[model samples]
Target chain A: MSDEPVRRQVTLANPNGLHLSPISALVKEAMNHEAELLISFDGNIANAKSTMELMLLGATCGAVLSVEATGVDAEVAAEAAVRLLSEP
Target chain B: MQVRSGIPVSPGVVVGPTLVLGSENFRIPRKFVSRDVVESEMVRFHNALDKVCQDIEDHEILVGEQLGSQYAAIFSAHLQMARDPRMVGQVEDAIRNQSNSPEYAVSRTLRKFAEQMQNLGNQYLAERALDIFDLEKRLLRELLGESREELSNLTEPVVILAHDLTPGETAMLNTDYVLGFATEVGGHTSHTAILAGALEIPAVVGLGRCLAGVSGGETVILDGDHGQVVIDPDEATMERFRTSQARNIRVSERLATLETLESETLDGQRVQIFGNIEFPQEVEQCVKRGADGVGLYRTEFLYLGGNKEPTESDHYEAYKQVLSTCGDRPVVIRTLDIGADKVPARIRDRFAESQNPMLGLRSIRLSLQSTPLFKVQLRAILRAAVHGNVRIMFPLVSSLLEFRQAKMILMDVMEDLEDENIEFARDIPIGMMVEVPSAVMLIEEFAREVDFFSIGTNDLIQYTLACDRSDPSVANLYRSGDPSILRMIQAVLKAGEQYGKPVTVCGQMSSDPRFVPLLLGLGLRQISATPHSIPRLKEVVRNISIPEAERIATHACSLDLARDVEHYLLGELGRLCPDLVV
Candidate 1:
């Protein structure tokens, strides 16, 4: 169980912006891994597990967000969140 | 604890637990929990969240089944937002650290987030604040154990206390469980008021923020007769209301018995009691109340609500529905009378603005000027006339020229229909509303041209007194009991008699029980009012003799002051029917 955090930056690709559907998808994907995941958008940090926290970030289309995770699944979770955010 | 008065739109008395329906901007009270009870407050918060989530999920599934997946997906978003961990954590933090109650914590946290979203200045993001507010209200309602939706799942009969009920909400009400309703907003002509009257429930509207003082399950005394609501009444007030309620029930029972009887005076002179309805659905109520026919079916409602102009077929369908429902009963359909403050922006923008719209282009004037619009309505009326006994009435005909011009348009439509070989009633009785003082002064000329005359006392009184009824500052001066208005009514009745044409009073005055004897005495053989008041009006009509009513009318006309006329009529009404409560 590594305490070191894995970090990745990804740009939101959805044309309609990060509304409830995209936020729900990201939260569901992050919850699949056993890691403490955090997403920061425009200097505002939010827990990736919280749909409302992701929504509060108000990350619009093409906005960049940094995904970070700390635990055994840190690498996988960070990669998954980044991939989901970068997906069409 | 306090008494509030408003305009009574429907008449009855009821006492029951108040069911306060949640509305937009409905506020939840903030309270603090003890420090030791912080954990319990957090538990309550989660429990409420779980309940709201389950409710949303159930609704989503129901919508998915009934509608398609695309429509149902909207509720899925709501569900995800409900279970959002960060929002739940924020609420829980408030409950634990600040010792805030679960409802207050949830409300405060959601409001903060919603404000943040709204302040983002993006239109899409700002709109999301509405979703947060909706969730907050739903959660708070679940925590408070009140139903989140209006007029749904009411287990017991109760008086509904609301800020206001939209026409759609008022339409879906289960009248069996909704004993009565009171709102903080609306007037006598609002959709809520008209619906309440049609449903035959006790309702008082325009209480103005008194609803905020009331909570669910509190006992309330709603006097729909006097338009009063007493919250948490004391022993004395409760006893008086109880007596009044019992007496009202007895009086209603007696009135119900008169529904099957003829509206005749003691001398056996029969009178025609008709109903004035705004919607085609009200035709059933008119028939149920045993109205001889519909004296005034205001068709302006066809133009009011919808986004687009009503097609000729739309008007035809409405008229057909009323005519079919009435069976052999005569249904007098009044043409579109939209103008003044009643004109919507869609129609108003098409015309030049009038500074004094009340005296400007409206009713028959607007109809004549807009030939295409008038012809479409005339064609619809003529087409619907084939279904049953349909009568056409033109409104606000100030002069004989306007009446003749309007009649000419009707003739043109009739010729067009004949050319098309569309079957229609050739001799459908045409009438004119004697509303303007000019029309009243020239009643003999109007009587000669029209098939019948229906005195529209509402506008006649307003025009006669030069007091706008909608203007609250001078509404009290818009009295039907004013001798000048009564004399105008008298003059119309004499014209109808001389021409051997039927004369009807289709106005608020005819519905008022206090004014019924005076109207009967003035020799108005036909009277039309809201369907709810028909039975009560019939009860008054059946009890009085024409000679006695005539004597009262003569004396009332002799009285100089409006107050004196009202006082004398009220006294006579009491003497005529001691048990009747007006």
Candidate 2:
């Protein structure tokens, strides 16, 4: 329910960082929330909903990513992104 | 006289002369040839391979036209591999180098190629040896009479002895003339055993190298029950076997007759007898053996065997066949019970390695996480439920949270289907297998949530005692008749009683006639086992009174020790039916 853009920094812990399946799961959850979500790693940002784009980011394990969402569900989007990154 | 023993795949004893169909021994070429002559030989070899491929194509067409497309496709695939350009090139080079014949050339070349491929370190290509060798051998056999060595013409019902038989050869076997089969080098789950089971032929596989010396035309008796193949029996031994064979036949026939017979005790106590199957082929066998319904249909075989995920239609067709075959009989399909051991390395590559896969992310864990694959199976099952009686069950659920989470997903899938107006079974009884010790301990909670419970005794016994049944050294530790396991079963049954839901035992113990009396004594009304074991179990059930079983149950429960429980049950079994033991 936040109008302002919410940003959260999280480190990828999965040995295989945001592999296709987990990335897909995160993308699916992001789509569920009414938020314009973007994930940035090493100055590279990608649409959280685009599987192909997220894969192209090449974010390996132990890399830090700052995820930002701006919309009615920005809080929910940031919460989901933080939660997904913490899982193996 | 020689006797060989192996696990009996099917029931029936065969008394006949042996027939050995040995592979033609290949000899290395010793002669030298000029380059021109070698080149000519290579051309001739390639032509011979072409002819063989053509023959297989023709045979495949005929087979596809006669039998189903599936059988024809197997032959077609073999033909394609035989014509592989790489293999053709290899054979040609070998022949050009003065290989004795096309057979010798292909065998030698393929062996070298396979070793090279293995050394290249590509697992996928390396495993193609069987595929390549099998195809080339079939072609070589067409070129020379030696390839037909495995197929022998028999006029009498003689026990066919062999080292191994391919599925095609086994399928081509004259069932009427072939009484039984014994092999030296096939596993219990080998293609030969599966084909034999499909054909309802009594077979013993994995007999090792001893069966080679079993001469053709020597009088031999195959004891499928004990996996024993007896030769040159004395008059008394022959008489005893004849009696045993007749009894086995009668017992099977009697069980079949009881297909329409009620699963009721002499005291008029009603019971349920179900069958456990892993494939759709076993559904018809269940009907033939008089199974009231399917207790646990392992759906893993659907997802297994293919590289990619099985389409919804694949799952639907398979589930539909099973449901339609069962008709009104309730079929409880257990969602994929696959573990790290069964899954291919590629699919397993995605998962984090666990120290113990048996207790790791398997069964419910795998399905819950793999939504794409799980949804496909769920949708298929739900869609197939339109045909007949079908229910869903989850496996390896150690906690109520897992069970509830699975049920929620099922509900969501059903709701989506309802929104789409897809015809599916509503009010399908959902259940969980109480195999894990934790689940068994907390059965009361599971019983309240699920409509039914089926105890998978195989896992319960193994996990409870920390023993791997397959390891012969620790097989003693995997006793199902152990008091601890019995206590677990008793707990499950009591929980089911408290919740007023039907509980059944659907593991190996259910089929063992030795343990039947003990289980029956434990107040279990529903029993699901392998279809073949139905009649023996039914006979045991029909003979015992509820009071007698209850008394045995009391004595069994009083057993503080494990082996003592087995002893007590074995004694009871010996007294009740001495013949079943041997």
Candidate 3:
């Protein structure tokens, strides 16, 4: 499989921001796809599949961030991250 | 006569004729189906799914308006999942293998997945099973041409009897006519039970198959305190229950008039009566009941009401609303009391999974640990304090050092705001709830530093009894009337006396009228309860003399055991007013 990187801008709809529950949701989605996923905001980057890393990002509500993934499932990972961010 | 028993989820003795709410699920035979028949069943299933989706969509507008868009997302997801092609493929495969109608096949397949998900043991994944089954059931009902059963509107009070109740269904109940509830399928921890407890309605759950035998309009006696449903009772049982119901009605009516009247003892001692509120809507109830002010405005509701952590603006708006409603009346805003069980959808991430959450990171402990979250809530409350007579309070302050540390953080936040040229109240009195046993043990030290004390008896009793209030098996052990609980109350009251600081009981026990005289007797001059209970508590307070109450309290304290003290108080209560028994 060809490895590629793709990124998308998403806004956190959850009020708790990038807290444990949403981070868990995002991590689960990232784990489902065969891709290396990462999210960045305010010059800080975190592995999308690592709850501890995502939480350290301190992404609060209404924060705009970019989720990027590389590998065969990068496109699907990007799409799923966008979906997670868009979820209420 | 048949009597069935289960766990009582709410306290209250309600007696009324039974109103059996029957749901007729359509039986679609599982047999080999021809291609043509499968096609028709598929169309029916889709039609049903569409209708249910439309129903959810309709509710979305209403619920969205109240709880905001986040809650509406649950339905939005459901709508999308209903039409997911993967689910469609699964349903088709099931129908082909079983030769059943599309709706039956879908329901059975979803049930299977739900069972499998249950065994997986992930809460997030397991919760999704309900959505799948709910959608399938909706589709099957529609395909089978069965309408959702609507609860009957009874002009007379009646006990609700159903096989099971959905959270939404229980939410829609008319509180006025529904005396109590009994269900056959749910346990004490079920959604129905939780909702019932929130509603403060008497409810009994997990009675097994006995619900099927109950007929509509049967003179059923639902003892919510014991979770016993008595059908076709003899005259004596009927009379006893009727009298209890009459007493309940009479007490409520008497309390209703107390809101507007000054809460002065018969000897003319003025006492302050405040209401404990969880939401802004309760302010109206407080006003109608003539509450002097809000003693404990639990600020956690702003966090708990939705999935996301409330913004500073959200916190400010809610605080402003409550403060504005109170006008000059003092409103003590307690900081977040979030624990493992009580964490709102918002800000739950800050907490780690604690094996013993009650003793874990929560209340002032959690607040002090996180400066950012603590400061945001503090700044918002301080700003709102400028709008009205708002006071700031902290929960679970186990030590004097913790109290000082919290105050230091508040001072830091205030200084930062001052540097920004933002306005806030710096002179607001800071108080702490004396819920933790350690706090109570050292009330004198705590009283010396804090401006006030609000005794949270619910947790006090729970911690003292070492019982989880939600645990049915040990629920009997958790009683505020226990001598140990009364002793703690007395200790706190005396500490307030020594320190000359205002003390208030602002827990579930405060709303309980039976305890009002006892609280007054214990020299507790300030009581805060729910808005609905404020008037009744006021009535009880107004009827007795402070000296008499003090005498009773002294007598109560003299008892060697908690049970004996409770017995003495109950006997005194009976002698005081036989008609007041509820």
Candidate 4:
């Protein structure tokens, strides 16, 4: 099995930023796959499945975030997170 | 010492140490926990979380049932935030790693998150910080084994100072130890103000941020008669307030002696002073205040305070209790008068959306549209009438046709009762509330059809002035003392006299002491008002002669400006009763 990670860059499109609702939504989406998800914003990396870590990132509207995943379904999980984050 | 003024809801003067309650920003005590007790601390944290979640859920259901699902969504958001696994994990981590007390950990963690949210610079998201802060306080309070002090536990009499109070909180206040209350927010017509009036507690609301400066145990004087709050007054100010308070007590005691006396003017003219009540329990208050009868028994409250539409038995039980309480004294029950902002969501959703509900389908209009609902209330009134002297009145009857239609419904209900051989009041006196301008124009025609007329000045003035009373932007124009409104009332009274049909003023105007003389001068011999105002109204009634009132009424009717009319009435009331507080 390959150990290399799948990664993508997504810009926050929600006018409200990564507030409780959007962060919770992201966490719920991240937990759906077997991939280990990590989101990095402004030099701070947070576990994509942790609401507290994502909220602490304070990734507001228009901020670009790096989503990295490493597992069998890493491609699927990373793609889904990027799409959800970029959707207005 | 400083003084601030607000809207006076109930009339009286009180001086006591302030009891500042319901501060949303409660201080959380922080402490360090030993390594051995870390597990216990986590348990305590989870227990507090569980309790808060339960409370939020219960409150959500209550708000959902009482208001509707729309308003109940607010509590749901709180519950979601509280139950967030990430937030819970963060708090527990703080407790174990930092060795912080569960209360401290929760407070610090939530505060940090809230601060970050506030810094996000989005107004809507920033406001969410308040929810987080509220949850933090609730959790901390629960973990610390502290519950919010119940207003019922107050030992010494105090003047309660608060930012604001919900209707439920206001209702649960123990009036025995509550000398008065002053709030930072609320208008004259707010539910807290209404509850204060019902409980006969002097209250000054809408004092703004000035109450924030007041601390618990600090001496403050609340003068609800003038809507003034004096914080930590000097000796001279204190002395003056004490004298004023003593005078108020003496005046009330003296007025209480007039309970048994007939409400009569100096020239031997008789006036009927009746009590306006919302609940059956207020009947005892009406009797205590020496009301001749129940002037206005608002039946709409039966529809409210419940989730679904009230059944016929619900109506029958409420009406029966009120009738039995009033005994033989005539109880005038006004039919369901719901509309505007007050309509229950269940019934409200059934009707077409109204742009302006106050002027739209409301009161008799809504009742007529929902015939089955209307008939249930009518049947209940009829059934209750068998217990005592009960009269039915239809509110907001604009035209003779509407009046006749409502009467026809009542007649049909009576016929059904007769067929069933159910005992009912065969000859119950039915009346129409003269509120709309159209009703005023058709008063003479209405007089011929209805047994009597009751002037509901609250809506009449609002409609006549083309102003919504609740709209602060136009509130200045919604004066009951407007010359146009006065003329309209005089017209109704003249028609009543012409047709020999009795007319009563059963609005806020009847309860206002300033308008008592003017109402009497307008030849309104019957007044139904809040029970607490009856004694003062009777005092004003006994002080003036019919000739004097007629003179004031003539002059007031001629004035074109509402301000001029109000000035003239105030001056006349002051002259007639020099010692009376207007």
Off by over 4 Å in 2: A1-88, B4-11, B15-221, B229-240, B304-308, B344-361, B560-564, B574-582
Expressed as tens digits, the lDDT of each residue in B315-364 for candidate 4 is 89988888888889999999998876457666768657878777788889
Off by over 4 Å in 1: A1-88, B17-178, B183-192, B206-217, B344-348, B351-357
Better of 1 and 4 by lDDT: 1
Place model 1 in a CAPRI quality band. Answer: acceptable
Fnat, one value per model: 0.54, 0.00, 0.00, 0.22
Winner by DockQ = 1
Q: Write the per-residue lDDT of candidate 1 for residues B1-582, one digit (tens) a residue.
A: 879987787888889877766565333333577899888777778888888999999999999999988877788778878878788878788788878778767766786778777766667777887888789888887787753433566667888888788655676678888889888877655556766876778898877655433435567888888899987889999998878777877887878888888888889989999999987999998998899999999887787667888899999999999999999999999998877746755787755777787898888888998999989999999999988998999999998998899999999999999999988788988999989999988889888888999988877887899986544456568677898988998999998999998999987788888898998898888999989889878888888999999999989999999999998988987887876754
lDDT of 3 by residue, B533-559 (tens): 566566666678988888888887787
| lDDT by residue (tens digit), candidate 2, B1-582 | 556666565556778766655454222222234565676666656677778778888998999889978777656555545654446666666566544455556655554544443443434444544555455456556545443333444445667777776555676688887888887766443445645755666788667655323325557788776678886777887999888878776656656776667777889987788988867878998887778889988776655555677789999999999998989999998987766445644477756778887677777898898877788788889999989898899988889999998899898899999999998888888999988899988888888899999998867887899876434355546677788888999999898888899999987678777787777778899999877778778777777888888888899889888788878887887777665555
Q: What clash count goes with each model?
A: 1, 2, 7, 1
Estimate the TM-score of every prediction: 0.68, 0.61, 0.62, 0.68
Determine which window of 10 residues in candidate 4 chain B has minimal summed lDDT.
B22-31
Can you give the DockQ of every candidate in the order shown?
0.36, 0.01, 0.02, 0.15
Rate residue B190 of model 3 by lDDT: 46
What root-mean-square deviation over C-alphas does model 2 reach? 23.5
* TM-score of model 4's chain A: 0.94
Q: Chain B alone: TM-score in each candidate? A: 0.77, 0.69, 0.70, 0.76
Stretches of model 4 off by over 4 angstroms after superposition: A1-88, B1-4, B15-146, B150-173, B177-193, B205-221, B229-238, B345-348, B351-355
